[model samples]
Target: MISLKKNEKWFWSGVVFIEMILFYSSSMTYKQQTSVPFLERYLRNKPLAGSLKHFGFNYGGKYQSIENDGYFHFVEFFVRKGAHFGTYLALGVLLCLALYTYFQKNNFLKILVPWLMATGLAAFDEFHQGLTGGRTPSVVDVILDSAGAFTGTLLVVVIVYFILRHKNMKKT
Candidate 1:
């Protein structure tokens, strides 16, 4: 049997929790996931509406379906993409922390493994989306998600390197 310290347990638990959320959300149809109604209500006050009214994103043909949705959809587009990036970023960080001991001596693996795992999750997410109605899976989204994961794992590597360097300086 494997033994885990308290911190390790926490990190692993977080990874599982986030993974569940990602999977659950992915399984939902785009219509089910839409936040437009909520956005509509919140922006009805006009002050907030005016500020973002003309805000636009020059999304490519891939997003043509949403391009005509006006301001609310524009905000939703960003919020959705931001969710994709941020969720995977957190997943990458938690995975790296949970697996740190296994890759202690191999700095390369320390960065690579978590990113790969997160990318795999992103790929699976796209696949799941395909199974849902009104959802079209995009390769571009997987790329965006992979970038987020890479950023996260690289952040962990840098932080650990600095901490080790500071400890060595203290010893000398």
Candidate 2:
């Protein structure tokens, strides 16, 4: 096992915690995870409903398409997919941070490792969903999750590059 500094420990812990949440959420049925009722209660009263009404897309799931699912389900589909993106984005960041101590000078590995790991987790999560009732494993969701991880890792890479450049400049 590799010895970790205090900050690295925290970062690794965050990665583990996030992974646990992803796994736990994946084990649940779609109905258990639905936030549609909650969204309808609050969002319908807000001015955003008018703008959201025109925003439409077809989610061709096993049950029904978005056209048959109506407005609230359409919104819920986006919300659910957004959660997938955001959660994996966070996982990518945490994984990158945790691995930074080992890969500080290796830019390629720094970005690649975290993204691959996060994508692997996304794939695993989708597989786990396949085991749950009312849940469907989707390749599109895995792709979306990968996109999120890529965006996150790229963000970290860019930020670290600038920080390192600034430090080197100050040494002159």
Candidate 3:
């Protein structure tokens, strides 16, 4: 596990957030053969090894195949490509991060802030892809993006409950 510094939660969360969006972006950005070298490069790097292994664990085991026959399809007409499950995993983490950050924020607006922020980020990414020579934006991608934000937000609330419960127990 990567040692997370107390102040690095946002950074890690942003990384996950961007990567989740990039999942579909990269699919639109490159052909299958072209994407393999990058994955190879990532796998050979040590810091990424743990993440790589985890991806495989989530993907397949023992015999690692280059072909990602997993539920998330890399090929899509637009940026909304891939399995909804990948979105679930990443959004779950990001939401946990948001909820942690919002615990003491105390305004009802605090609840909407993360959702809006994620929506804007996802929208911007799709817009960026649309401007790119090879890609175009899709309403489906926007919807999926919102779905990811929703999933993330839900995760945060659940985690906060556990954290608070644990804290209460400790104090008792």
RMSD of each: 3.4, 3.3, 10.1
Candidate 2 off by > 4 Å: 1-6, 58-67
Worst 10 residues of 2 by lDDT: 57-66
| TM-score, every prediction | 0.85, 0.87, 0.52
Candidate 1 backbone overlaps, count = 0
Structure candidate 3, residue pairs in collision = 72-83, 95-152
lDDT of 3 by residue, 79-115 (tens): 2334433554365456445454545555344345566
Q: What would the per-residue lDDT of candidate 1 be over residues 1-172, giving only the tens digit for each residue?
A: 0232347889889999998998899889878999989988987653455656545544434433333677677677888989988988898888888888788889999899999999998999899988988888888889889989999899988888898799889999
Output the number of the TM-score-best candidate.
2
Residue 2 accuracy (lDDT) in model 3: 22
- Per-candidate Cα lDDT values, in order, are 0.82, 0.81, 0.52
Separate clash counts for every candidate: 0, 0, 2
What is the Cα-based TM-score of model 2?
0.87
Off by over 4 Å in 3: 1-5, 9-13, 16-80, 83-92, 95-99, 102-110
lDDT value, residue 158 of candidate 2: 82
